[model samples]
Target: MDGALEKSISFILFIIIGIILKKKISSGDETNGLKSLILTLALPATIFIALLKVKVDGNLVLYPILALGFNVILFAFTPFLIKFIGIDENSAKDRSARLLIPSLAPGLSCFPFILEFLGDDALAKTAMADLGNKFFVLFLLYLVALKWHYKNADFEANSLKSKLKSLFKTLIYEPVNMFIIVALILVSFGITIDKLPNFLSITLNRLSFIMTPLVLIFIGLAVKIKKQQFYQIFSLLILRASFTLFLIVGIILFVDITIKKDILIMIAFTLSSASFWPFAHISAVHFKEKRENTKEKTFDPNFALSILALSLPISVLLILGILTAGNTFTEINSILFLGTLLFLIGIIFPIINKIKKFLSKTTKEIKPITKKKKIQLIADK
Candidate 1:
């Protein structure tokens, strides 16, 4: 009966329908085709509308700065966090986790819900936040990954300038970025969405309408993760989220966020799924390592795929649940409890595995002594 409840249910239903249709949508290209539409057409349109609708100002730049700050913080701290999962330092899998855990792909995982629940103003804010995340994942992570590649492959870094220049081109030509720039230019010239010609404004609105359902279904269709890699990625993702919650709590404590929805926007945007761009960087490095015939590789591409596959559902569910709960996570104490709870959940399995190993070792030791004791007693008799 309630509006928010209705929207949440519809989204869940779309995702469930996607999961059900996964069998029919068997090809990767089929999924990619859907993704192409979302990224190039639907998603960009939605973001364009959101941006145009909002008043542009100098203060908006702070969103990207803050988002970039979060990325750097996560990157610095992730090495320590991955150690909890027994991911050996400097291993291929370890490197893959490090590259992924900090990047944010909010378009597919975050924006739809923000639009549906938090409204366009919040979505506009989040779109700005994503700009910083884009730079982190695209340029910074590439450099970091390349450094790792050089370390393991034992080759001097080459063509970095060419690669970085190419990434700059990608950053410019990307459909979302294009729309954002156009929208800003329009806003600067004193033109808002309502001020635009009826034909142009109406078309953008129609395109924005498809973004939510399309994303929800794509998430549904893309939901394929192996059981073996599930636990490790799942735990790490939870820990990542827990840390993000802690950060948001700390920010709210100091920053003056008067709006409740704004806090939710920050939480939801930061909790987005790991970007697919980092995987592209990993793939490129893998290709180079192969050509150079390097024995020690930089990243495990399979491991990276596993991380990305599992990330979407986990982040979607988390953002959805927290947003659905409304102001529940707005308080400091509630968020603290959530962060601590997630942190404990992340470590519990590793702790259990250690206890199991200890018990098995104790049993093995006891069996040998028991056998010796029985033999001695029998001889005496």
Candidate 2:
């Protein structure tokens, strides 16, 4: 068996263990601690070390540009797409879609697979691409959430300014952002991981190694689906998956694939799970609204939770299919077909309902005429 596949299996088993542990133990605040560890310590260490270790190339520059470009295009269309799909503006579902659609979680979903399957080169490219995604999630999406959050309610100008300032401070002071800055400074000076002090290198390496298992376990613990939300959440996920698949196909058809590694890196990046940043933003919104006693709520914590829970498995499955199928059009074509079908279904759902109602009315009208004819026949006899 392939080493990558073996590692994938092992990672999944650890996730299963996490899920089982969640069942037996009262998670309470421990889940938050795990998430903090992954986000503030583990993931940053991993990304910092990876960036320093990888030899910088021209492709590195192109990768981030492509990643940022993809995000911008998707974000530009998201509001229109949400409106077209009948999601109300400034609503919970709308807010959730806005957050989930543009952001990508390459660190949690794509990085592991890229490292194991495509080797360090591909992983490096993905890490760079994630820089763009990280920016969108941390900065752009926060602004978006804040913008829509204030749309349905009123706030003082001073209050808004204060909130924005606090958000900026939070972003700048974040551990991840700090590490990114450090990595950039090192890159500017042409310093590589090899030149790092041995003690510091070892510490970062040890911290980085915990990232995957901790994140996977966090995902397991976070998974939850209420019976009522199943259909609604599933429909949203299908819509998201369909659109993402469409984007991937567009890239394949138009983008030059001169370098196979670049294409694979692109595919891995594209298939990444939804970022957890959305959940954080939504929870913040909820907390703020509650404190302000706002009756009109635009953010839905449940929707954010559902997306976070389900996106990983969906992303993993898609990435696995791509890797296993040797990145052929056959699997991609299959995804396109499913995506197209889902799109059509979403478009025509109301029409289907109207037609069903019309047919039921016609059947009911015909049944009355048949009864009247039978009565007339009996009277004539």
Candidate 3:
């Protein structure tokens, strides 16, 4: 618990420091560059390092299938649920997007943490599971959902084909995938690299350390909560949380897959939050559309930010509660605790923003009276 608490605190501190430094040193371009680094470099490296040494087994192989199956079930049944709930088509598409997009990086988000907690063997199995989920999301659900959302627009097919091509390109170029392939080839031939020079291993290990916190901070930096969209954002958060919880329970009960408790916690964490990348993509697309129309668009930065911020803490707490409640808090407790800490750190940004907004408003109101008094004094002079 202490270690987890410390990790949470450290996560919060680093994010705050990053945000502050970003404000001072990072222009919009720099911030964008930071995002690019996370997506292209840090995240992929982390995934590769974590999965490279992992050992896969039959149970591990089934986990991703179960994850993909659950996602498929959600995508198929959620539309019907939306229809029954009387949500409009546009709203249903948004709901589906929220549900489907996060499945893309379940492994990326959870695998490193799982590796830290469970070890290479568990991570390898989890990677296999993650690989399945990523393939299903990127290739299947992502394309289908994009088509559903944009089907009626002019140039729909062209747009869909473009998106499919983008997805394929992403898959082909992803460092994580390349790493997996290389690692698999190595492992298949019984070529052991674990005995590699200590210095290189240390270097890779240090690089891997940068991956998780950088990602969490990137998530924090990306999500900016505004005042007006609080209610709507909160509702969406509840929707995501509810859906993830339901999926977790269903997989545990109905699925024949057997994973260790730590892995289960990782799966729960991975599925529980929406993917930050898709939100960035959606936001970018919306921004472009608004620009082309020559109309100002109200993009809800806070909505996704709030969702991510809230999801982290909830996931950490959920993981901790489950572990502690089951009395299964073994060696992995440190990792679970760290995860919870990271989430708690995530929650603070919104709170800080709210406070800053309140103070800014108060200062603005006070400034008018001070200006009036100064003007009156000048007249008297």
Candidate 4:
């Protein structure tokens, strides 16, 4: 087998192992423990090494801007799709969908795969892209969620300065962000991974080594989706991913992405799973609603949970499948075909439900009358 196919098999096997081990893993806490290790240690080290390995130039500035722009587009597009899907406007579920669909969580979902498949340089580019996403998720979306809270309840938001200050602190203090900043600073000077002390380099590389396996296992163990909202969530995620592909296709047509690896990076990075931060924002609002003793909520916790639970696995499948395909999806026609296929896939269930409803209604309208019933009616007359 080719190298790509072989690597893809290994990744799938690791995930399967995790799923098998899920039977032995008793609690959410264990999954959380593994996640903590990845986010705090392995992921950061991986990003640090990736960034150090690459040459960070001026064009790198556009990455975050592009990422943030994609978020805004998805945010704007979500409501129309939600309404078209027959959800009630401004309802808890609608609000939750709006917040979660647009946000990208590359740390857990995309980074490891990028490193393994696209190499360190591509991973570095994706890491830079996450900075803008972090800002959007941490600050802008937080404000939106807070506004939602204040709209429904009697609460006050702090001054912009205070909120910005706190958010700035939160951004800097995060392990991933810290590693990114440090790596960028080192790169700004004349330092590369090779220039680093041998001991530190060895340790970081070792930590990075465990990231891919740990992440895949966590995905297998952690994905807890209920059947209640499966179709809705699955359909929404499909539409979300389809829209993402179309958007990328538009860009590829206009922009100059020559390298297959670069094109894969664009596809994989933009298609990262929905961020957990939005759900955190949703939970914060839920907490305040509880404290205020309010009957109504700003966002549906269960809906948000459903989105988060299913997003990673779906995105993992997508990113893995796309990246593994190598040059198959590098052209415009292939991408358009894939996106169209996903769009159709997303709409098929809803269409089937509508058809079922229509058939039922028509059957009810045309009730068949038997000869005995007709004779009985004539006799009564």
Candidate 5:
């Protein structure tokens, strides 16, 4: 718990610094540069290091599959959740949430905590889990965005094959993917990061060290909030948390994840923040379509931004609480903890609305005496 708290505090401090820099210095270009540093250098180096450290085997294979299974299941269920929350099916939020809510962004939010609290083995497992999610974000979500962009339009008119080819090209050329490919080859031959040349290993270690602060600061710089969309974002957050809680309970009841450390990892993974890459891909499509003067609404940038802004704090608090509890709580207590949270979020808003209405009615019912009536009463007296 202390470790979790310390890590959380440090993470927030970096984010706050980023926010201040964005406000005072107009670090827009700098922030973009930092993000490029992350995607092109820091993140890829970090991934390669993690991949090389872990033994590639049957248990390792289970991680990506488990992660992908979670993504797919959540994806299948999101539409119903969207409908339940009363979001308009035709709205841009709907389109974006379908992609955003199901994906996991452990790199930015979860990794630092794992490193600080659970050490490298846990971090390795988390990184492995993230591979499946990365695949979804880079490939499947890209196709979904393209489809939404050209849905009503003719495929031949837009040269769909060329568009897809371009998309695939973008995916393959990303430094992250390239590094993954290289790392896989190395691991296949029983190589590890330590076996690399001294200079290369030192340089990579330094780059990877910057990953946490740089990513957290970039996230802070990128935080843009829309007041109108806040409620929708909150609803989506609640929905995500509730579903995750349900899954946690299911795991406790049915699964044999007996190791406390593993259980903690699973809980944290289940509650990881939604990834930003899907939003990035979707935003690119929207921007390109806007340039081309396409009339169809593509994706909602505001909605995506809202999710990004809210997900960090939501995920941090959940992880912090779980970690502070220290994996000692019984299964019933774990269920009760999540159940209480779910209950509060579900019931609080309606109760507040009812209270507001009652107060309004009571205020309207009481009237002030008019001057004429007061004068008549005084004269009569």
Candidate 6:
């Protein structure tokens, strides 16, 4: 099989396996815990190891800065876009989720592709850049977005501080961060493993292989939709896609960024759509909202999942389209094209609802209101 075809097939197989597991499995604390383990531990270690092995150059600074700038721009514009799209004022959590989703590309999915297509050094640089993007989205963007939504509430400050603290603790105490720091130190000191001990290296590689599948499975497991929430979800999706396209095109025009084939691959990865983090944030916000006796609104999980799923296939095709579209589609064109596809997919929630049903069998259970639910809810107060 051809290389691209092979990768595509692998991705499809991964998704299929995920769907099967998700159908048979329940989203209980155990599954959630496993997801956390993969995100906070296995994924980060793989990234750090990959980065540590690669050679760095000036692009190291450039890529991360670009990633951060891209995220900042998205966050700034998402609110206005949300307003223009006419999502209810009470749907701040959903709005934030919408904004944050585009900011979070599937980092794990793109990493291996980066390593393969861009070589070790570019992968290292992209890894650092990705770390910056992750930090900005997870810490800065999320906190501020949450604050904006919860602004009028009496306990907002305390709630914000507590959430920040939790984020901080998670960042600091996570094994991945520690490993990354250690790896960086070793690299800075010009220490090379030359050959990593076979057992250690093998273990790391095994864990790394599991990371992508685990993430995709978690996403598959999280897929959900509601007939009632389709319009709101559709509106938010459109806004996100538009903003993402604007950023991608604007960056290409203003910046002297070269469009290396590797960058093309990275753009494909970055442009593929949002990830599960936004859904997690939505859940957090909903938990807070419930505490304030706000109207109970169900979050459309399929909104983000659909956006992500459609993004992958569409982006791959878009990249191919741009590459083949004569000389007119420059690197900038590729970015804009991919960004626009994401935007379009973002708006098509009805399509997503249809896709979601085909992908997963276990619908999310809407639980009755309880003290636990109240403590966890965070929407319209």
Which has the greatest TM-score? 5
lDDT by residue for model 1 (1-381), tens: 645445545756787888888889974779768877887888779768876866535878899899999999999999988898768898998999999999998976888788877888898889888878877986699778867765575335546666567456755876766887898898889899999899999999999999878866776777556764678778888889999999888889888776788888989998998887686677667766777788788888778867776777778888888888878977778889988999899887678767988999999999999999999999999
Measured against the true structure, the TM-scores of the candidates, in listed sequence, are: 0.70, 0.75, 0.60, 0.70, 0.77, 0.65
Candidate 1: list runs displaced more than 4 Å.
Answer: 1-56, 155-228, 361-381
Better of 1 and 4 by lDDT: 1
Looking at model 5, which ten-residue stretch has the lowest summed lDDT? 327-336
Clashing residue pairs in all predictions, respectively, total: 0, 0, 3, 0, 0, 15
Better of 2 and 6 by TM-score: 2
Better-scoring candidate (lDDT), 4 or 5 = 4
- What's the lDDT for all of these models? 0.81, 0.73, 0.53, 0.80, 0.75, 0.58
Q: What TM-score would candidate 6 get against the native? A: 0.65
Cα RMSD, each candidate: 5.6, 5.5, 10.9, 5.8, 6.3, 11.7
lDDT (Cα, tens digit) per residue for candidate 2, span 1-381: 766566657766777877888876566678867777776798789778866875646757777778888888878877776665556786777888788877898766777778876788677778777777777886678777877776666666447777678667756776776887899799889998889999999999999898778866776776576764555455555566667668877776786445656666776687677887666666666767888798878787656766666777767776776776665633556657856976765556434445877999999999999999999999999
For model 4, what is the C-alpha lDDT against the true structure?
0.80
Q: Model 4 over residues 82-154: C-alpha lDDT tens digits?
A: 8766678989999999999999988767887788778888977898788778778866897888777667654
Superposition error at 13 for model 4 (Å): 11
Name the candidate, 1 or 5, with the larger TM-score value.
5
> How would you order the candidates by lDDT, starting with the best?
1, 4, 5, 2, 6, 3
lDDT of 3: 0.53
Give candidate 2's error at residue 44 in angstroms.
Answer: 3.7
- TM-score, prediction 1: 0.70
Candidate with best lDDT = 1
> Which candidate do you rate higher for TM-score, 1 or 6?
1
List of clashing residue pairs for candidate 4:
none
Q: Which 10-residue window in model 4 sums to the lowest lDDT?
A: 2-11
